[model samples]
Each structure stands twice: as C-alpha cells, then as structure tokens.
Target: MLQKAFKRYIDSFRGFSKEIWILALITFINRTGTMVLPFLSKYMKEDLHFDYDHIGTVMVFFGLGSMFGSWIGGKLSDKMGFYKIMIFSLLTSGMLLIFVQFVTSFIGMCFAMFGIMLIADMFRPAMYVSLGAYAKPENRTRAFSLVRLAVNLGFAAGPALGGLIIMGIGYKGLFWVDGASCIISILIFATLVKEKKLSTHENHEDTEKAVVKSVFQDGPFWIFLFGSYLTALIFLQLFSTLPLYHSEWYHITEFQTGLLMSLNGLLIFFLEMPMVTFLERKQVNRLKLILWGTFLLSLSFFVLLFDNWAGILIVSIIFMTFGEMFNFPFTNSFAMSRAPKGHEGRYMALFTMSFSLAHITSAKLGLGIVSRHGYTTNWLVMGILGLLSCASILYLKRIVAQSK
Candidate 1:
C-alpha cells in the first residue's frame, strides 16, 4: 500500500523536473532548521531565564526583519531571478546565524535577531515567486500541499532534533545545526536548481522600477494581500500564545508542550493530501473550504479554554488541523490563480509579503491580547478576527461573481 502510494505521488507531478524536487527538499531543509526558534523560545525563557519582555522584543525584531525581507525579495525575484535571490538570502542568513551564537547581551542579541530574520525571510518571497513557473494552475493547490507536507515532515523532526541537540550538546548547538543546514542548501541550490526563471520566461521587465509597478498596479491585488496577512496573523497565534495558555492554565511539562506542537505538524503531514483529495473530489469551492477552515481554527482556540487535560488539547488540534488542510493550500492556489499573465513573480511575491507581514503584526497583537485580558478573552478576540477574515473572503467571492 505504501509503495503504491509513493508511486502515485511521483506520477502526479509529471510537469515538475528533478530540479523542482531538489528545490522542495531545499525548502524542507531551511524550514526545518528555522522551525527550531519556536521551541528555542522555551529554552530561552525557562532554562536561560530571560524575561517575557525580552522574548517579545526578540520576536518584534524577527518579524520586522522578515517583513522587510519579503518585500525586498519580491522585487529582486522579479528582476534578478528566483534562484539568485534565494541563494544570496540563504547564505547571508547562514553567516548571521554563526554570529548569533556569540551574543549573550540583550542589545547585541536584538541586532543579531534583525539581521538573521531579514535574510532568512528574504528567501521566502523569491521561493514562492519561483513556483508560478514550475507547476500548472489546476495542480497548484496540490503542489502547495506537497510542499507543506514536506515542510511538516521536516518540522516534525526539527523540534525533537533540537531538543536532543539541546540535551546532548547545548542550546548553541541548535544554531550551529541551523547554520550548517543553510550552507548545505546553498550548495545544493547552486548545483541543482535551474528551473527557468519566472521573469525571463514571463518576459517581465528586468529593471527595478518595472518590478515595483508589477507588484502593486491592481487594486484587488492589495485587497488579497491584506486578506492573506489577516489570515496568517489570526491563525499563527497557536504557536506563540497557545503554549503559554497550556503551561500557565494547565501546568503541562515542557516535554508535553513540545509534543503538542509536534502533534499539529504530524497531523498535517499524514492527512493533508488525503484531505485535499477529498475536497477536490467533492467539487468544493476553494473559497468556501478556506472560510470553513477559518471558522474551525477559531473554534479550536475558543473551545480550548474549557478543557482540563491533554484530551481537550487533542480535540482542539483536530479542528485547527482540519482548518490547515484547506486554509493553507487553497489560499496559496488562489494567489497563483489570480495573478495576471506574465506577472507571476509579482503576485507570488505579494502573497509572500502578506503572510510575512502578518507574522510581524500578529506577534504584537496575539501576544498583547493574551498578556492583557487572559486566555479566555484572547481566544474570543481571535475567533472574532477569524470570522471577520471569512467575511472578507465571502465578499471577494461575491464581487468576483458580480463582475462576471
């Protein structure tokens, strides 16, 4: 059964060359190493004894850096080509990581944080921008699903690997691992990643000014951009604040805490493809599926405040995981579908920017709500936000219909 399943997945993406697979694997490597930070925060606070404000400050720097990087990357990808942009960003980030380990002071760490995040996130917009050239629209969502699955598989391994590295060697060791992985990816990319450039293939103007106009010319582009930001901000609080809620309210151990996150990633890895297949077969509207996903995700956080043990956490995860299967891939597919001809990089860059911007804004908003009003109110506010996001999608869908 497993053999047949693997063969079928191989057959599905006949458009993608071996180079694309390597690109995907490189993505998995980068994401896996980067995913260590969420778990690293716990070590920083609990073991190293940093205060909450310091943690928040570090997050702020990371977010701001990523926001700036995404914009810069988008513009660069439109002119310089995807592989070039991605390689430079990754190598720069890796070099920064080597420096991050030496910082023991607060001010020093903040500066390092900004540099690391800026470079790490710069690669993302270029990465997404590249995808438009490689895969067909009908299979685009599936392509994203497979990519997410790859990242999740890497994500699932990363925390445990980080944990063991922390246990055996030290916290600094994690950064070393991340830096080494980035170096390896940079080398692989230089050799194997030659999927034709989005700009030259699409004949986008090679000038910087031209690339800037391409990203923001249309009004609806901005609308979807803001929508993607909201979607990311409202949903991603699960990683940052959820653990705090579980720890303070339920007093769960650090091990169990990491385990719950692993559960989220694990669920995505095993179930995403099957869920996407089911939705496709049902002829479900992608927009509706995403909206439903938003509701379920919001509901998960709201319901969790009432649970006493891990059981409730597990149940809540089921909702969020269900939401993820539809919410993540469809939104990405929508971004690709909506791009104007010959401007794939611009649209994909916008999509990446929106999502990256949300991470920055949500760090402030999600943390502020939970820190101020308590977990119950935090969950409630996020639910309201999620519903508002759904309304935006519904409005967009309606507008599209009226135009037709």
Candidate 2:
C-alpha cells in the first residue's frame, strides 16, 4: 500500500510538457535564492534599527512596487510576449538586489525595497501567462501546482539557508546570494527556453465563445478577487508579523523561526500536488475548496490565540500550510479559466494585483495593530478577516452557479 501510494504521488508529477518543467525549474532556482523577503522585517528592526512602524511603511512600498510591476508585466506580456519580460525582470531585479544592501537610511531603504520588488515581481504575471502558453488545458491546474511545488521547495531551502547565512556572514550575504541566484535562474531559462508568440497557443474555441468582457465588468471575478485579497491579507502575516512574534512571544531563535517557516513550504512541497491532483480528478468546485481553505486559514490564526505552549505554533503552521495548499493552486486555475483568450495577461495581472494589494495592506495593518494593541489582538483581527473572506467566496460560488 505504501509503495502504491508513493507511485501515485510520483504519477501526479508526470505528463507535464518540457516547457512546464523548465518553468518549474526556473521558479525553484529563483525562489530558493530569493530568501531576503522572509526575513526582511526582522532585518529592518534588528540590523537597521528601525521601529515596527518603519518596517511596516517600508513593506507598504514593497507591495506598491509589486502592484505596479504586476500591472506592467501583464500588459507587456500581451504586447511583447512573456519570454522577454521574464528575462528582463530577472536580470534587472538581480542587479538591484545586490545594490539594495548598501541603502541604510529609512527613506533610502524604503525606496530600495520598492525598486527591487517592482523589477522582481514583474516576473509573476508573465510567468502565469507563460503556463497558459506551455501547458495543455487538461493539465493546466496540475501545471500550476507543479510550479507551486517548485516554489515551496525553493522556499523550504531558502529560509533555512538564509538563517545560516545570517548566523555566519550576516544579512549582507543573503543579498549577494539572492542576487546571484536570480541571474543564474534567468540564464538557465534564457538558454533553454526559446521565445514563442503568445498567440501560438491560443484556444480558438475559447476565443470564439469568450465574451471578452472588461475585467471590471466581470462581477463574479471581482467577487473572487476580493475574497482572494482578504485571504492573502491574513495568510501573508505568516511572513510579515509572524516572524517577529516567534522572537518576541516564543523566544524562538532566527534559525528556529526559519525551520518553522520551512515547515509550511515542506508541507506544500510534499502534499500540494497530490492533493490538487486528487481534487481535480474528483471534479470538485474550485471556489468551494477555496472557502474551505479560508476556514482553515482563519482557524490557524485563532489557534495562535492559545499562546502559552510553543507546540501550538507547530499546530498553527500546519493549519496555515493546509490552507495555502488548498487556496493558492485552485485560485490560480480559476483565474486562468475566467480570462478570455486575448486578455489572459490582463486577467492574470488583476488576479496577481489582488495579492499585491493584500501584501501592501497586510504588513502595515498587521504591524500597526501589533504596535498599538498587541499580537493577540492582531491575530483576532486576522481571524475575523478570514471569516469575512470565506463569506465572500461563498457568495461568489452562488453567483457563479446562478450565472451558469
């Protein structure tokens, strides 16, 4: 039975195209080297001697850059194609990462963070659009999960290694490594993957039947984005505020915190593909799964309310990891499905923008609450937000069903 289960797990990874595999590899390399983010808040506070409010403000600029990058990347992908944008984003952002470490003042750091992220995050929507070009329709959701697996796997390694780098040569080492990795990942991609026209893979049936409505006109899609925004707002706390909580509340060391963060990635690495495969085969409603995920996310934060035991941190992370595994892949697939053929980049840009917006809000709001009220109050606020997100998705499901 164990052998059979293992085979099944392996089988879920089969059948992807060569391009998809290459994309996944690039994602892995890029994310693995991109370890600066998981510890950025801590770096600001401890290394730069910034207060919580300053860190939050810097992060807001980071998110603003991400938002602008997503919008531009998606627009350019439709016009110039995903390949050029991907390469440009990686190369420019890699160079930026190396220089960002030199910026010490609060204002300088904020601009540095924003500029780096603006270049770096431009890769996101373009990458998503590339999957549509590369993966077969039948295998698309699994393809998203495959890339996500690479991301999580990279994340699993990145943070643990980052912790060591910090302990040894300090945070400066992280920036150097991060910059090199981005350049390396892009080199691999550029050498192996030739550019293809975005129109090459367009589904004629999809285009012919597609209404081509403006993203703003799509009511259900807007509802879905709002739900996603809220879910992301809560989930992003894992990276932003949670690391500080680990130190201040639990007295967990930086390495210990990295390991804890790594657990989220490890769980997604092992379980996300198989779970996504199983659900796809079962033909489950994506929105329903998303609602369930929102519930888990909310519960994860509520679990943190029981702050006495360190073991509770493990349990809370488990819930949050499961929430991520369920929420993210389906959300990607659903957003892709909603896009009309020619406007895929626009739709994807909007989808990614929701998360960027959430990233903007998550740090400032979460850190603000922590500075003023405390962690317990912040967690409670996040839990309530999660519930609201769940309700939004539930309503979205009904709207979709009635429209169908």
- Number of the predicted model whose lDDT against the real structure is largest: 2
> How many residue pairs clash per model?
0, 0
lDDT of 1 by residue, 337-386 (tens): 66655565567766886777777777577778877887778778887787
TM-score of each: 0.86, 0.90
Tens digits of per-residue lDDT for model 2, 247-359:
99999998898788778877887788889889987878788898899999999999999999999999999999999888999899889888876777888998999999997
RMSD of each: 4.5, 2.9
How much is the lDDT of residue 367 in candidate 2? 86
Considering every candidate listed, which one attains the maximal TM-score? Answer: 2
Off by over 4 Å in 1: 1-16, 39-51, 199-214, 278-283, 305-310
Misplaced by over 4 Å in model 2 are 39-55, 102-106, 166-170, 198-210, 246-259, 306-310
